[model samples]
Structure formats: C-alpha cells, structure tokens
Target: MLNMNRPNDVEAYIARAEADAVKIPGLENVRPRGIASAGVIGGGTMGRGIATALLCAEIPVTLIERDPATLERAIAEITSIIERNVTTRRMSADEAARAIKHLTTANEIEALEKSDLVIEAAYETMAVKQDIFSRLDRIARKGAILASNTSYLDVLEIASSTSRPQDVLGMHFFSPAHIMKLLEVVRTSATAPDALATAISVGLRIGKKPVVAGNAYGFIGNRMLAIRRHEAEAIILEGVTPDRVDQVVENFGFRMGPFRMGDLAGLDLGWTRDTSTGATVRERLCEAGRRGQKTGKGFFDYDDQRKPVVSPEAMDIIAGLAADKGIARREWSDDSILDRMVLPMIDEAAKILAEGIAARESDIDVVWLHGYNWPRHTGGPMHYARTLGLDTICARLKAMGRTPSDQLRKLLAAPQERQ
Candidate 1:
C-alpha cells in the first residue's frame, strides 16, 4: 500500500510538469467593454478604497453612503490616503487633488442614475444584496453593468433579483481594494459577456489583476480560505500550539503564521458569521467573550507593543476542553503539523480547479499571492502544490482522512490532476 501518511514523492515530478503549462484562456468569447462611467455603493473601508482606486483611474464615481457622517468619514479617509501618497512622492499634490475631485457622494442609491457601472460594496447578506439589485434594476441605466464586491454570497441569486440578470456579475475586491491587485470577477450563467469584460477592464484600469471565476459560493480565494482555516483550527484542537504552527509556516516561507493572522484580522470576525453553520467550533471561547485583539484576548495575549504572546488563559481553556473530551494532549511533530496544513491546501486547490470555479491554477495562485497574502515568491498555492505533486496531495489528504470536508467534497470526486 502507498504511504498514506506522507506525500507521493514519485508523483510530485508529474504535477510540477503539468503546472508549468498553466496559461490564461483567451476572453475571445466575451464582449470587451461598452461602458465608461463607474459608481460604488457603501463607504466602509472596502468602499473607500475602491472609490479611491476608481477616482485614481480618473473615472467619475459616485460613492453612495447611508448617511452624511459616513460620507464625511470616507472623504476624510480618502483625503488622508491621498495626502500620504503625496508625502511619499507617489503622486504630486496637484494630481492627488485632481483624483479627489472626481469622487462624488450620495446618501441614496438613486443618485447613480447616470452610472454605466454600479458596484455594491455593501453588506454580504443575501437579502440586502437582492434588495439592492432590485432597486438598481429600477434606477440604473439600461445596459449598465451591476457588480458586487462580495467575498462569498451567491452572485447568481443577486443576478436573479434584477430583470437584467445578464448584466449582474461579481467584482470581489480584496480589503483595501486600492492596494490589492487581485480581483475575482465572478460570472453567473446569466451574466452577459459584455458585463464580465467591462469588469475585467475596469479592474485593470484601477490597477488590479482580475481573474474570471465561476459563480460559486465563496469563489476561489474564500473557498480556499475556508479549508485553510479548517486545517488551522483542526491542528490546534489536536496538540500543536498556535506559536508552533506559526513557527513551522513562517520558517517555510510565510511572513506571519496562521494564528497571528487570526489575531490581527480578529478571531471572531469569521466565527460570528459562521455561528449558525455549526461548521466551526467557536462557542467555547466566543461564549466567554474572548473575541480577539479588539477585546485584548484571542489565541494569544498582547502587550503595549501588540505583539502576539501565548496566553496562559487560552492554554487553560484548551486544557479544560481537552480534559472534558477525555482527549490526551498528543504532541504533534513539527513535520506532522506542517504536512497536514499545507497538503490539505494543495488538495483544496485541485478540487477548486476540478469544479471549474477558477478557470486555471494561475488564477488560484494569483488570488492567493495578491489578495490572501500567501507568500509571493513561492508562486501561490497551486504552484506550491505542483512543487510538492498530485499524488502527494492525494496521499497526504488520505493519510489525514481529509476529503475537502462536506463543503468541498464534490470537487475532489471530479476528474482532475489528483491521484
């Protein structure tokens, strides 16, 4: 029998050769661009950065906010960013001012009547998105493209809200959309070729590298992220310390380890949204009100420097939980922890491609490198997988008894570059 506990060293060579053939499929089948003016809704962090990027591209953008105070705050944030750019000699004072002038704000969505493109940077709730799209269908100009900066949520359902479903698409911009180059342009079956083309063009115009993805829940980046988080949490539940997990990854290449990332981004951010799913094991710590860095507690404690130091409180909690479960604390070897985490990611990537969600491995790699902050020099997750092999991915996954979880099992069952 094959060594299910480790990678298939023989197949790693074959996978590397296959990944080397990765390329961009031509958009020859799609309409390129017919619209010019752009508008963005919501004035949250993502909205502000997206608006700034659009204005920087000199495209007239109406930033829709719910209230005057929000508009003011967004304007202040945009101004602060521009001033910093000027200070760094990235842009002249005159150029910065010019870009700032192109931004217009409104307290209502109806103000976007003249926009050729309107992107909702609002809440990720399905109801809210459907309502917004319904309203936009009534207000937005005919042939105008409608886009969403949603990380997860179904684009097809949002498209269904409008009579012009063909024009609805996803333009998932990473946080601080102005800086991140990767953008996932999700296309539903009803989405028109022209709309997708325009989204890609606009992404490029705003200095983003847009990758076309199929309309799937969470799409490529977030889907991969879900699996990544699952693997991270699983290890912690076993025996590996957060610090140890971080050490193994950082030593391999990542700038920061998984726990540090969870702390900085807030441990409660995803869990709060996932409460009903029961897919996550959050109730234990969350019910105790130990949210994360904001509450000055999480996987680790922080001092004035805000550096992550292992929390005795957390260790106590882990111990109590383990004892309650009658589970012995097994010291996870460094290799076991690293193999379990990384191989699952590669397995997830194979599943991602097989589902036809991401058009190619490069797209998956691009999102990981630019958006999710996966170590860049390694050439993204897919590339990392190729470096390791298809058989190796399968071997490790089988060894760990991981099969994409219920959320992604179908993809693994598909015919693809997996052993």
Candidate 2:
C-alpha cells in the first residue's frame, strides 16, 4: 500500500525519493571551472532572466543584444525587476544596488570575448541558434563554456556549429528563468565531464534544482507532455468538453488544465495566420482571431477582469471537428477522463527511461513537479503510479487496447526491477 501520511512519513519518503535519482559515472570526480563572469545573448524575456540570475549569484553579467533599442529595453526590464524586489522586501535596498552593479549591456557579439561562460537564449530556431554559436566560437575566449537555452532544438547540432563540441551543453531553463527552480542540464555525447560539472555547479549556485538529461528531442518533460497533449485532444474529439477535462485535472491537483494553459500561453505561439486552415480547432481559433487570453478569447472567454468562462464559439469548433471526424459522442466520467489524460504520460516516461533519455524515474518526476507543476502531495507521477500498483496500471493499459512500451513490459515482468 502507499504511504500518504504527513510529517511522520515525510522524512522516510524523502529519503527513498532521493535514492531514486541515478548517478552518472565519473560525475563526482569532475571539478567544475569557476565562473568569474558570464555572457547572455538575446535580450528577450528569457535572456533577461538568465542575466538577472547570474547577477543575483554575485557573478557579473555581460548581456548582448542585436541592436541598441532592444538592449536598452532589456536593461530597463532588469532594472524594474530589481526595484520591484526592493519594494516588495524580497531584496533590501543595498542588495538591489549591488545586483545592478554587476550587470553590463552590449550590442556586439565581440563584447562577450572575455566571458568564461556564454549562454545563447536567442530565438528557438536552428538557424538563429547556430548563427549565435558560430559567432561565439570565433569571439569567445579559449576554454570558455558555451551553452544554449533551447527548450526543444538538438543540442548536438548546435554544438556542431562550434569547433569545441566537448565544451558545449544545454542549460535549458524553464520560462521566467529567475524564479523557476528547475534547470535541465542536457548533456550531449561529446559533452566533456567538466562541462556538465560547470552547468551543475552554476545551477546550484543560482539556487536551482539541476537534473541531467540526455540529448533527445524535448528531453524528458516535453516528450511526455506531447503525449499528454495528443491524448487530451483525442478525448475532446470523442466527446469530452474542455471544461470537464480542465476541472478533472485541476481536482487532481494541477494548477490548470491543458486548455486553460494553452489560452494563457497564447494559441498563437507557433500559429501563422496566413498558413492556418479551419481543419483543427486551434487553427480555426487562431484564424478567427481568438488567439488566447491576451485577446480575451480562446477555448474559454474572459470577463472584463479576465476571469475565464466557457466559450460557445470554441464549443462550436470542437463540435464541427467531431462531426467531420465522425467520432461517437458519449458521457465521459471523471475516472475515464483522468485515465485517458495521465496514462499516456506514464507510458512515455517509461519509454524515456528505457531509451536512457532520463537517468532515473524520479528525475522525470522532478522535471514535472518543478517545471510542469505536477502535484507535490502526489509525490510525482512515477510515485503516484506505484501507489496505484504497477500491475493494475499495466492491466488497465492492456484493457484499453494500448500496447505498453518494451521497458514497461520488462519492468512489469520483473517485480524486483521496479524503481
């Protein structure tokens, strides 16, 4: 049975949880290079957060932008953040002044020549990131650590743009980087031990929880998220409403459901108006200018104060898709809703573990708990699965006519091999 007690059970659970993290060979022996100064390319929201984090850790930062206006805007944003912290008592007056003192802004890539570590937090495209890495290869000081803040791009391909592939790694920070505690230290095949060490050390210095990830598309969290997204959309097509789905997930302890999250993040993230057709609900919504919360409309409509309510327009689109696809509609109970949504995530996590993309099952759990806001009371998805009994989950997957991944099957076949 699962232990769900508080305080009394917390310490023992934490001990077992920590033991679940897998250790990479030779990780302990590598001594990380000291970071005296850092460089952050791009002055967007993500770049500003990276620069602010370095400054807060007492490491000086040289932030580079493509033009003078953008550079100034980033500088102003950083300043405003510091001032707000002071006003809110998150930082004292003197501390805020000192943090500002350690920051410098530049418009040229060459200005980062002396930095010990330079991170590219530019646009999330191969062309843009490769161009930045190529420039850094020639300008950055010899032996400098080069990193990318890409959330989904290939780290190896980015490293190939630079001559020192061994020194290149991915330091993927969750959005709003300064506040988020999770830092995915993505290691490529050629990543030197010391490079990984430096990334881990820097993460720790900045008060972040660091987990090592292999060089795979979307790494751990995003890969599983893709599966969950597909399943969410599939169930909607079958009969479930967005509100019902959102409520079920929220009751399970998530901060928000997928549809609400999509609205808040904006449905227009990758959607281009010119290329959009009314084939899919999201595409149709974007085509109709129902982008997201910023526009006061999306899967849910917002009030004057921005509280969300169900939208008739969105329901109409969903109905249209259901009619076109000829999917049967039925009443979806909360249990079925929860199963359809979360089971795929567990399956994908199993595949990731089997493929060696994640070092441990708990590491995947950590990514979801901190980055994706999986409920802490549930002790992460993997632990929760164990609580449900792995055999029971496997049986349900089979009963649903789903083919379990090889790793999951093996794990089920061997009782002692379970994490």
Candidate 3:
C-alpha cells in the first residue's frame, strides 16, 4: 500500500497516475491526426479562452459567432488576453503579435468548413448544441473532427445530430481553458479511434493533461462535483453556516469551500431573469439581484476589493427557507460537516467506476486532481478512499445514514492486492 502521509510519495503517485491517464488502451497503435488549424464556435468566456489557447499553440483559429457585436467583442477580448500575457512577461510583445495574427473571426458556420477540428463551446443547453452540430455537419468538410465543450449534456446525443458521428467527441475543458491543465476527452461509442487519438494529441500539444472518459453526464469531475454541491447545499439548509462549511473543506486542504466556489462562479449562471420565483435559496438570491461577485453580492457579500464577507441578508434567506421547509436548525460538528460534504462524492465516484464512465481508478483521481484542484497530498478522491480504508469508508457512510455503493462494497470484499 502507498504511504498517504509521505508528501513526496503522494506527489510521485500523482505524477504516475497523470502519465497513465493519457494512454488509451485500444488506440495504442492508432496515430493522431495533426490539428494544424481549428475553429471554435461561440465567443463567450470559454470560447475566447479556447481560441486563445489554440493561438498560443500556433494553431490558426477561426472563432465563429453569429452576433456581429459579440464577434467584435470576442476578437477584442482575445487581443486583450494576448496583451495581458505580454504585460505579465508570460509572452514577449513580438510573440504576442504573432499569436494574435493567427486568430480570425467570423459570423457564420461556413468559416469552419476547411478547419481541421471544430470545437463547439456554445451555450450549455442540449438544443443549442444539437442545432450547432447539425449545421456543422452540413458545413464542415469530410474527415474534419467535430467536438463539443459540453460539461454535462450527452455527447452521444450531440453526436447523433451529425451524420458523421465517428468524427464527433467531447473535449471538456475547465473554465479559463487557456490556463487550466485538465481536459476530459470524452469518446462516444461511435467515435472513431483516429478522432479520439487526434483529440488526445492536440490536448497534450496545448499543454493540457487530457484524460479519456466514456460519454456520460458531467463526465468525471463535474459528475462527482454535482454530488458534493448537492450535499453542501443540503447541510446549509440544515443550519450549518455556509462559511463554516467552507472552513471545514478549506481546512481539509481544498483551495476553497463549495459556497465560496459557487459565489465565484456566480449563482445566476443558468437562472433566467424572467423566472424570478423566490423558491430555493439560489432562486431567492437571484430574485434579490444578488447574482454573485460580478454584482458584489451572492451567498456572501463582497466588498470593493471582492473579498467575501458574511451577509446577514443571505443568512436570513437561508433561515427563512429552512423554516418554510420545516427543517429544524441543528448545529453540526466539523467532522460531520466534512463527511456530509465529501463522502457523497466518494460514493458517486464509486458509481462512476462501476458504470465504467472512468477507464481506471487512477483516471478518476487524475480528473479530480487536475480538474478540481483536489489536494495533491490526498492523491484524489479514489486514492484518498483507499488510504482511509474501504471498510472504514463504508462504515462511516452507514453511520451517516448513507449506503455505500455496490462498487465500494465489492472493493472492500476483494483481496488487498486488487484494492
């Protein structure tokens, strides 16, 4: 068994796991096609970041946006990003100029026809993505690899929109795609070997640590993240302060706690302005215009400097919601709070494993480690569970009124060597 307490040993384990993640088994002999030029659909934050990353890699990029104004803004934003790199000394002025020269913008899908690969970083809704893919199928040239940057929607369904399902796949990049290292290369059942290989190769070329995953909702990182977020929200409703919950997680080694993360990401990300019903805490917060840091308020209030402070208004909202739901306020110990926030994620990871959404245990670890900023010392959730002992984890879940997944149970029953 690996020594979890040794920092060097943990680091080495993570390195090996990451190295192993990119080596897809069946595609061992398949060569990756070169991605000389690329196209990115949508010019939003993610699309801009992706276009910037491709430009930095010296890959000619055509960024497509239907709105002329949005297209102009995207071009300006991309130029600003390159200029910022020069200001930060990350890129020389001359190099920045060269990178900017490679970016081209357009207001139609026809601009992507000759591109080697086209990644749709459009809106997250399935209908929007499917419509884009349907048009891409007609516009993109034969053998051009088509991909989606969808975080949760079904890649198979998106692929189904196209006649060339073999050319379709998911290249799920985390926020700030220009900087974050993790990339989930999701392959649908119909995805061609060469197409998958090409994505993995291009991901490495762009300085991303790519892990191949089966097509599934949320893929690996976000699939597991949904569980953690759900539990975090649940505990707050039960009377644990959001900051206290955050403190327990931060103390456990994460960079930030769930509520803080939600605030940073903005609570109104998918909430529509028209549907202003004061139902859930999030809806109530949105109804009040406490969208997030952008508006200087969210679950926590932000000062001019953007640091989070406890918001009495937010607290009242939570309390009122709890009372409305008839949930009694109860103080929870730090350990209980930690368990409530994290154990469910571990359980969901087990389900992901059992369902074969992740190729190996280490792949899941890689997803959490690089994508979610899982503490390096913990060796990701799956490894952390093993370090805690499968039997111990199962017992803890049982005590907390949760059932361990069948996969976890099986791992517990197996020989130590297998675990």
Candidate 4:
C-alpha cells in the first residue's frame, strides 16, 4: 500500500507518474515529426497565448486572424506579453527581439500553407471549428499537422472535415496557455501515431507537461470537473452557502473552490444574452450581470483587489432559485460538503478509465495534479481515493444515493493482494 503520511513518498509518486504520462503504449517506437514552423488561427486570448508560447520556444509562427481589427489587437497584446517577459527578466532583451522576428501576422488562412503544424484556437462552436478545418484542409501543407485547441468539442468530428484525419488531433491547452504547464494531446480514433507523437513533441517543446487523452467530451480534467461543478451547485441549492463550500474545498488543499474558479473564469462563459432565462443559478447570475470578477460579482463579490467577499445579493439569489425549484434547505457539515463535491468526480474518473478515455489511472491523476491544481501532497483524486480505500468511497457514494461505478466495483472485488 502507498504511504500518504510520508511527504517524500507522495512527492516520489508524483515524480514517477509525471514521467510515465508522456509514454503512449503503441507509439513507443514512433518518431516525432520535427516542427520547424507553426501557424495559429484566431487572435483571441487562447490564440495569442499559443502564439506567445510558440515564439518563446523559438519556433517561427504566423498568427492568422481574418478580421483586420482583431488581428491588430492580437499583435499588440502579444507584444505586451513579450515586453512583460523582458521586464520580469523571464526573457533577455535579445531573446525578445528574436521572438518578435519569429512572429508573423496575417489576415488569411492561406498564410499557414508552408507551416509544419497549424493549430486552430477559434471560437468554441461546432460550426465555427468545422468551417476552420474545412478551410485548413485546402490551405495547410500536405503533411503538416492540424490541431484544434477546443476544450470540449469532438475532435473526431472536426477531423472528419478534412481529407487527412490522420494528420488531425486536439491540443487542449489550459487558459493563459503561455504560462499553464498542462496540455491534453487528444488523439482521435484515426489520428496517426506520428501525428500524435508530433503533437506531444510540440507540447514538450513549448514547456508543457503533455498527457495523451482519447477524444471524448471534456477529455480528462474537464470531464471530471463537470461532475464536481454539478455537485458543488447542488449542495449550494441544498442550503450550503457558497463561501462555506469554497472554504471546505480550500481547506482540502485546492488553490480555489468551484464557485471562486467559476467567478474567475467568468460565469457568463458560453451564456448568451438572447436566450438566457432565470432557469438556473448560473443563468440568473448572468441575467443579473453577476457575470463574475470581470463584472465584480458572481457567487461572491470582488473588491478592487479582486479579493472575494460573501455577497448577500448572491445568497438571496441562490435562496430564491432553491425555493423556486422547491429544494429543501438543510444544514451541512464541512465533511459532508467535501464528500459530495469530490466523490462524484472520483466516480467519473472510474467511468473515464473504463471507457479508455484515459490510458491509466495514474494519467487521470496527472491531469488533475497538473491541469486542475489538484493538491500535490495528497497525490491526486485517484491516489487520494485509493488511500481512503475503495470500500469507504463506495459506501459514502452509496449513502449519498449514488451507485458505485462498475470500474470501482471491479477494483473493490479484486483480491487484496492483486489490488
């Protein structure tokens, strides 16, 4: 059994797991393609970050934005990033100059024609991505890899838009891509071994901790996160204050809790003004312009420094929503709140493993540890669950009116010696 009490043991396990994450079983012998030059489509936050990462890696980059105004803005923002790096001494003045030389801005897809790899960080809609890929099919070089930085859209469906599905994949970078370390290199059913290998190579070249994930809804980290968010929202509706819930999670070692993270990421993400109704807490929040820290309010209010304070207005909104839906309010212990928030995510990880969305349980842990800021000392959700014992987890989940996943049941039924 693993020893959670020893800090050294936990650190060693994480070290080993991170090393193992890059090794895809079947692609062991496949050589990664050289990325000589790259192209990035879109000039939004994600696109600019990706371009910055590429430039910092000393790769020649052509950043394509079809709109003249947006393209101009992207160039300015990327220049500011380079200037900041120099000011912070992260990059020397000479290095910043070279990075500027390496960057090229264009207003057309055809600019990517000679690039070795092209990534589309366009808007996150099926139609928009499909359109981009269809254009890339004719524009990008024959053997050049095509990737989508889509968070949740189907990469396989996106790949189908091209004649070369083998050359297509997903490079799901976290927000603030230039700084975040994790990259989910998603491989579709038709992605070639070398294609996958090449993407992994590029991820490493840009100083990211890359993990191979099978294409699925939300892939690894976000898939499990969806469950945690659902449970977090449910508890608040059941009468736990958002602050109390966030505090419980923070005490459990997360950098920030779900509501706080939502607030930071903006509650209005993917929410539309045209179609929004007060059907859910999030929708109501958006409706009220409590769109998050950007607007200075969400589940919690933010001051000038962006520090959060409990908002009576938000609490009243939550209470009203619960009452409207006829949900009974109840008192909750911190332990209960933690269990409800975390256990469902553990169950979702089981489903991810059983469905081969992740190659190993350790890979899932790596995703959480690097991608989602899962506490390092506890290893990760899976490692923490194992330390808690599968029996205990199943019992808790069952008591909460949830069925244990078949994967968890199998692990439970396995002989103790084998387990």
lDDT of 2: 0.84
Model 1 per-residue lDDT tens digits across residues 321-391: 66666666677778778887677776666667767887766667777777777765565676666555556
Candidate 3 stretches greater than 4 Å from native: 87-89, 273-279, 412-419
lDDT of 2 by residue, 249-290 (tens): 999999999989889878887688788777777888888789
Per-model TM-score, in order, reads 0.86, 0.93, 0.95, 0.95
Candidates arranged by lDDT, highest first: 4, 3, 2, 1
Q: What is the Cα-based lDDT of residue 45 in candidate 1? A: 88
lDDT score, candidate 1: 0.76
Q: What is the lDDT of residue 290 in candidate 4?
A: 99
On residues 1-419, what C-alpha lDDT tens digit does candidate 3 reach at each position? Answer: 66777988888888888888887878889988867899999998899999999898889999999888888888998999899999999889888998999998888989899999999999889999999999999989899999999999999999999999999999999888998889999999999999999999999898899999889889899999989988887789898999999999999999989888999989997799787677778888888889889999999999999999999999999999999989888878999998888788988887887788887788888898888888878988877887888778888898778988887878556643322
Candidate 1: where is the Cα deviation over 4 Å? 1-26, 29-31, 270-281, 403-419
Over 4 Å off in model 2, which ranges? 1-23, 67-69, 274-278, 412-419
lDDT of 4 by residue, 276-376 (tens): 97888999999999999999999999999999999999999999999999999988888889999898998898889879898877788889988888988
How high is the CA lDDT of each candidate model?
A: 0.76, 0.84, 0.89, 0.90
